[model samples]
Target: MQVRSLVSFLALAARLMLLGGLLLGGLAALAEDRPWLTAEERAWIAQQRVLRVASTPSYGPFTFVDAEGRLRGLSVDYVSRLNELSGLRLEFVAPEPFARNMEALRAGELDLLMSLRETPERAEFMGFTRPYVSVPVVLLRRVGSERQALMPGEPVSVGQGFAAADFLRQRYPDNPQQVETDDKSMLRRLASGEIDAAVMDLASATFQIRGEGIGNLRVQGDVGYAYELGIGYRRELALLGRILDKTLARIDAAERQAMVDRWISLQAERSPWQRRLLLAAAAALALVLLGLGLVLLWNRALQRQVVARTEQLRIELAERQRLQAADHARALAEAANQAKTEFMSQASHELRTPLNAVLGFAQLLGGDAQHPLDALQRERVGHIDAAARHLLILIEDMMTLSRIESGSLAVTPLPLQAGPLLRRCVELARPAAASAGIELRLDEAPLPLAQADPVRLEQVLHNLLSNAIKYNRPGGWVQVRAWAEPARGLLIQVADNGLGLSAEQLAQLFQPFNRLGRSEQQGTGIGLVISKQLMERMGGQIRVESQAGQGSRFILELQTS
Candidate 1:
């Protein structure tokens, strides 16, 4: 009987081990299926099997109720995936306006809110999951209008509860807001010109513009704000927040992209004719770009040609101007020469005739045999003759100077003996030196033959001798010397021990009609000027050396044969 009891115990032990193994296998499978949930989370979810979620009633593409009252949108699709992945039942509450839904969530009437932008104020009562959807906010305006920013005092419509509305309120507070119930209302107002512009999310605006057949509106630009949408639940439901966050993270990138493309692609919403129009526009743009490239190349070549031609024209203009200026200068010189010639001819005719007649009558009176006169009367006749002769000499000198300046005076330079020429000039100037009581001396040194016009050289030497004698004090001496230079050819010097010039007087010495304040002297002031010009015409130069209270030395240099 004891042996029978032992066999029964062994059978019971085998059955108990099999039952325990089966129970442990079932629990392991359950843990594998819901690895993201903790034991406490699972119990919490089991207690609250269905959670009520609500979103903006008319927000399209993200969350909306269809015309058939079916809950459908990007957020609904996400919740469907969440339920599939997490085994959590997230039931949709009846669609309501966003403000009402927000109030419901705050009042703890709703378990969760979909497509919400978490804010600090909202977070006080709610817990949020990581964002699952993002969309840019955009501006809407009439098709032809061009407003880039909100203007003060301008009415800009925005959806009442959208994050973009708050953004606009803070960013452009001076701009008045025409708060509308939703994006649809704001867009309608923008389309009808009741508001200047409207701000809303891009997806909803695009969906509504097409759905409502609002053809007069266009997306002006982005408003620099985007909606980072996520789920919001009561702050106490931390377990629910974690469950939702895990579910969101598990909805991989590929699945999220497919859902987004299905709703947000404008091409999917476009008609067949619109697609055809787009293709045609693409081809036209390609052709225009090709033509523009060709035009740019041709324009560059044309610009190079223009620049080359402009530079050429500039050079030609400068050359022509230079030639014109030269011709003008030459013409002016010729006119001045002609004027001088005419004046000299008139002066010779007008003054020389009277002076010659006066000299002739005076000479006739001085030698007349029929009129025997006293010594006083004879002296008076002598004075008249001297005055007339002086006037004649002055007139002749003026004529000679004018002829030399006008190039009418001919000069014929040749190799000439200097010694004979010097002796003859000295003899001619001796009587004047005697009258002034000045001694005129000539050096006996042998001189080289010099290149000069004979008559012009003689005239220059005679003028120098006359000036030396006339300006000298009593007992002063004048000296003439000549020598040959191996490099300089020939040099003749006429020096004077007389009233020497100061530094200031030397500066004005050669200027015509400037007498260096010696106006009382019997000289025309143009003699030195004429002599200097004549020497230059003969390929020679004349220079002076003098110091005040010392003496004056004048030197003439000429080239030799």
Candidate 2:
């Protein structure tokens, strides 16, 4: 009877403790739930119909919670703007990975996704709004890295992945390419000069430039391009779609751009507490030296103050920086990976276009018993063979680009003078210039010396001179010049009276496979791509000036000795 009474007493005490804690917690929760809603917010939420929005987090500078735990950035801002404009009440929800998000929308658990890449494949599953932002998939590479090759030419490379593979299949199906999945393996290869370039998003490239301490890697132009980003929703949500379309359209282009600039800038700001923690650390070290003074000063009550101060200072600061850095890194890595996948796809398409024809004719010649070629047929076969060889060069170039990316090939150095090499390039290209009735002339003297592989230098000159001649009108003139000046590296130039470029075309000129109206000429569209890579490797720079229909001038600068 005594033992049972004791157990019952203990159980009753435990129940009272739980009841007392629950009552106190309820009061605290009530205090925290007080909402300071603005007149606009109250009006908006009052009309709330519970419009659920499922979006992927870590979609940085797009739809992410800020340091203060408020959802902000381009997409978030756009959506909030949308809510204000349309007076639609929204309930933000976590995005289910892959098809689950779409499935939720179908089940009416969600109204829409803030943004999704527009593609024909996705059209069946969802309705898309017209795109407001154009984000091209660009090559993010170490600035000094070589350009990727498309064919059998011995050249530097770009890394490959899903985007690159799809690009290859769509653009260059007949060409051969090597793909990579491991990241450390890719960078190690690139560092060794095996692969030449890596694909990455334009925005993420900036973070990489800062983080990797790579002064050279930069974002090239849109290679294969990317799917348009649009608001995605269930096709049945026609009423909601109509409301969003009107609201989204109100954001406009300039406003959208301003949002992007502001968010990216805000992302660069470090938490103020981070700096405070550093100061507190220094203060603690100073206090550590005054042992006797601190001991008496730090009673149990003083000890509580010290712990609270340090907690707010170093420990929390360290934790926040660690999380922020990790988030920033993940965002960029995902961007680079997407770029790599896109590059592979673009390279594939470019390779296959020529190979399809080459293979078609080679098979004809192989059908010996079925239908042998006569003299005319043999002549045609010869033409096809020549064309196939040219196509083969393109494939080799892409393979080499992969190898350069993978770090399997090595460069053989050659020494030579600068002035004479320019003259040789002029002489070699003179035939083509004459055929088109264009004059090719050497630039004036006062040329400086340069240390480089003579053959590589010649290749650069040849590309510039050829472009100047080919792109020019009949009776136009191409001038080749090389000069050295104090404080600047060796200056080499090729100017031409040609159909010039607008600002946009000039921006994209050196990107691989971007033909830029030179497609009519018998070329793989990688001449300048190769030239740019080789020049950079030799520690040189290539720049161009052009006005539409006025003419174009290409300037090459190399490091002086």
Q: Largest lDDT belongs to which candidate?
A: 1
Q: Go through the candidates in order and give the C-alpha RMSD of each one to the true structure.
A: 49.8, 21.2
Per-model CA lDDT versus the true structure: 0.79, 0.61
Instruction: Please name the candidate that would achieve the greatest TM-score relative to the true structure.
Output: 1
Q: How well does candidate 2 match the true structure in TM-score terms?
A: 0.38
TM-score of each: 0.44, 0.38
lDDT of candidate 1 over 1-561, digit per residue (tens): 899999999999999999978865664555458865777766555445578888666788878778887878888888888888876789898889988888888888899987788776787899877666666676778988866455667777888766777788776788778778888887887888888788887778888888788989876555446676789899988878877775665665467778887777544357899989999999999999999999999999888865357788899999999999999999999877666665674456458757867988888888889987689999999999888887787787787776566444545455577777788889889998988899999995776667776667888999988888877899999999998989988898999988889999999988987888987886778889999999998899999999886779999999997
lDDT of 2 by residue, 1-561 (tens): 999999999999999999978865664444333232234343333444677787643344456544576665566777777766555666678634434566676676787776566555555667766454544445445555454323333222333322334554554566445455423344445545566655433343343344344444444433434434568887776555545554554554457667666654313434699889989998998778788666776686556655357557888899999999999999999767545633543465346545866777676695676777788887877787777877776775564454334322223222235665566667889898999999888866865456454545666777677778878998889888778887777788889879999998988887878887657777667777877777777677788899999999888887665
